[model samples]
Target: MFNDGAFAQITKRDKRDAMLINLVHGEPIRFGVDNERGVAMDSSGRIELVDVVDVGVENLLVHDETADDPSVAFAISRLATAPTMPTPVGVFRAVERTEYAAAVSDQVDAVTASQGAGTLEGLFASRPTWTVS
Candidate 1:
């Protein structure tokens, strides 16, 4: 029981909202106001927006050393013979990017120990170089 114009308007709103979401990572400013009383400079010599309150955390990185493991446990599901329903065969734990990087570094070290230095560099298709005139 929906009209064409209403559907088009909703679609346009959704598209605009999605585009805005992609542009802004966190919260978006809904409104802003400048006090006409007087202009004051901050410590950094910049005019501060006193009316607007801080929305989210300023520091994006979690620096806590004692933070719990962020890795997640997931199961591999497959369709078995008898029943059509999927069955969980194995459970695997995901590792963080740092863990992967460390593993790669260890592998590189092992390769260097047996193959000697600069072997990995030679394996690459192109080597970066800068010439100063």
Candidate 2:
């Protein structure tokens, strides 16, 4: 149950059916004009789809009932950052793998000893010059 002021603030000047529906259902639903643009979350916890034109319909993935603590805020932030559609799942996975590979390469380079200029060129050029001087 939200305060009348809060409810009025959400409903006032917004005649969207989606917003009204969300408000009546007591569930938080987010809307955005486009996927690339900013999203607006209905914090009133009601489902009323009054004006669904400007606000695009997006499915509710997760909800937070106890949002009074810092940890809950962090969890919500993580959820929001997660991929909404599965179309980019493969690309996202590949990017994660590439990032891991780069991190491992950097670590290996840090641990490996630096070779002399001659040895560096030989190693880089894939030429094997085995002479211990």
Candidate 3:
């Protein structure tokens, strides 16, 4: 019930303020907002995170073959997968530019090591706002 022609047309849309994204990371991937799944920028300049979207079929990547080299494969893979999503949805960091989960975990490990006690764990665990929702 989907149109290949219409799907390919996904690339033609505007790409201003495009955020660099990667679920399949090699280099920072440029993703124009096809449509925002849910996250919206608030007046405070803090982006609101609604849900986590992992790197998978459900979080589809929009790419253009004629426009980009690496983009085509990711786009096609997204098209082939079932239950793929449009828009780069999730809590994204402007720095790491990788998948949100990877950025948080990987960067944490890269910065310092986690020891037994009297460590950063206390700082993180003690914070009231740190509890999982």
Highest lDDT, which number? 3
What lDDT tens digits, residue by residue, belong to model 1 across residues 65-118? 232442211111111122322222222223345687899999999998997887
TM-score of each: 0.20, 0.20, 0.18
Candidate 2 to truth, TM: 0.20
lDDT of 1 at 29: 19
The window of 10 residues in a row where model 2 has the poorest summed lDDT is: 86-95
Model 2: residues with Cα > 4 Å off, grouped in runs: 1-39, 44-50, 53-98, 113-133
Give the alpha carbon lDDT tens digit for every residue of 41-100 in model 2: 456643222233455445342334333434433433333232231110101111123577
lDDT of 3: 0.39
Instruction: Give the residue spans of candidate 3 off by over 4 A.
Output: 1-97, 114-133
RMSD of every candidate to native, in Å, equals 21.3, 15.7, 16.9
What lDDT score is found at residue 39 in candidate 2?
A: 26
Rank by lDDT, descending?
3, 2, 1
Q: In candidate 3, which residue pairs get closer than 3 Å at backbone N, Cα or C atoms, i.e. clash?
A: none
